[model samples]
Target: MEQTIQKRLPVGGDSWVTVDVYGEPDTPGLVVVPGVMSDAHTWRHVAGSVDAWPSVVVVNRRGRAPSGALTNSYSLRTEIEDLGVVLDEFDSARTLFGWSYGGLITLLAANERPIPQVIAYEPVMRPFGRHALPDLKVAEGTADWDRCVEIVNRQISGFSAAHVDGLRADPHSWATLRRLSGPLYAELSALNAEPPPDLMAQQAEQADLIIGQRNRGTAPYGTSFDHVRQHVVHAEVHELPGQGHLAHIQAPAELGHLLNNLAAI
Candidate 1:
C-alpha cells in the first residue's frame, strides 16, 4: 500500500506526469494504462491485488489527472510517444494491461516496441459499424459537462434520482474525469471519418488481445482473433463470457488471475 507521486522529466519537451511505483521493486514490472477520461487511480483495485509484483506503473496520459498540457494532436502517434516516455523510465520490458481507449494506446505502443507482453480489454475499434460518424458527432455535440451528467442520469434512469445524485456526488470519480482533454470528444467524433484499419493491422501483429464475449462495441468481440491468429504467431486471446466493457471493474478477480498467469508466461 505504499504510495508516492513523481513527475516524469519532459519527454520531447512535454512533461509526462505519472504516479509512483507500487509493490515490490524486485518483482516483474506491470504497467496499467487507463482509458480516456481516466487516470492511474482507476487501476487501484487491480494494482492492489497484484502488489506481489516487483513493480507497477499506473500511467496518467497527457492531459489527464496527475499529467499536464493537452496536445492539440490527439493522434495515435502522439499517444504512442507518451507511452514510450513511460517505457523509457522502466528498466525492463514489462507487461502492459490497458482498458477501453487505453487498449488502443497499448496496441500502438506494442506495435512500436515489441514489448514482451500485453493484455488489452475491450478496446474501442474505430468505425464501430452502426455507431458511425454522424452518431459520434451527435454524441460529441451533446457531451457538454452538464449534458454528460444528463446522459449518465438518463442511462441510469432506473435508479432513483437521489441515487444518481449520490453517484455524481462522488468527488474522486468526477475529479478524475474532469481532467480529460476536451479534444477527446472531438477525436472520438472523427472516428468514422477514418477507421483505424492500419492500427488494427499493426495491433494484430503485436500484443495479445483479451476480449469480453458480451462486449457490444466491437464486431463479434472475437472477430479480430481470426484475423490476427496467423500474423501474431504468439499472440493469445481470451474470452470472458457474460462480461462487457467494464469487465475489469466488474470482475477484477478474474481479470487479475488472467494477468497474473500471463505474467508468468
Candidate 2:
C-alpha cells in the first residue's frame, strides 16, 4: 500500500472539503465520488488495481470526519457544487466515476456542464425515488446509527441479514458504518423531494454505466437502471456477473480492472 495524500480544498461556499489521493501526483487520473455511507478509502483498492490510474482522488463528501457537516440546508445540489470544485482541481483527469448516490451526483453534475467522460455504477435514480423510510428516521432521531445502517443496507441496498451481522462484528468497519450512516438518512430524505432523473440526458458525453448482474431486479438499483437508460440516452450499460450492489467491496480488483479498461476505451 502507498501513502495517501490529504488535500483540503474550499468548496460549497464557506466550507472546506477533504479528499484522499492515491497513486503518484503527476499521474492524476479520475475523480471518484463514493456512494451513501462511504468515504474515500472505500474505493482505494479499486484505485490501486488500475494500471494506468496513477492518481485517484476520492472526495470524503460531506458529513464525514475531517469534512464539513451536512448543513441544515443540505441536498443533492450541495453535493453537485462540491463535486464541481473537486473536478476543477483535476481537469487533466477528465474522467469521473461515481457509485450509487455519488453516481447520481456525477450524472447530475455532467448535465449541468460538459464532461468528456462520465461513468456511474448503479446510480440511484429510481423513478419516484421519493419513497419514505420512516423506520430509518426513527433510528436516526434516537442516534441509533448501527440500526440506521442496518435499515439502509437491508432495505435500500438489499443486503441480507447475515451480511449486515458480519459488518457489525467488525469494530473498525462497524464504526465507520455508524459514522457514515448519519448522512445517508438526510440524503435519502432530500432525494425524496427532488425530481426524478427523467431528463438527465442533457450531458454525460461518453456515459458508461455499469451494474452488477445480481442487482438486475433489485429495488432502487433495478428501477435506477431504467431511469438512467431512459434519460441518459448515450449511456452504455454493462453488467458485472455474479455480483450485486456491493461489487466494489466484494470484488474490487475485478470491478477496478473493468473500470480501468473502460477508461481507455
Prediction 1 global C-alpha lDDT: 0.59
lDDT of 2 by residue, 1-265 (tens): 2536888888765676888887765565778899887887787788777665677788888788788887887888889999988878766666789998888888888888787788888888643234446887789889998888888878776679998999989999999889888877788876666675566636666888898898786666877776666778878888888887788898999988888778888
Give the Cα lDDT of each candidate: 0.59, 0.79
| Full-model lDDT, candidate 2 | 0.79
RMSD of each: 4.8, 2.1
Q: Which residue pairs show collisions in model 2?
A: none
lDDT of 2 at 216: 86
Q: After superposition, how far is residue 42 of candidate 2 from its true place, in Å?
A: 1.1
- Give a tens-digit lDDT track for model 1, residues 126-227: 533223334434555766554444333333112356855665688865544443534455444432245454443253333666777775344433443344
Give the Å shift of residue 2 in candidate 2: 4.0
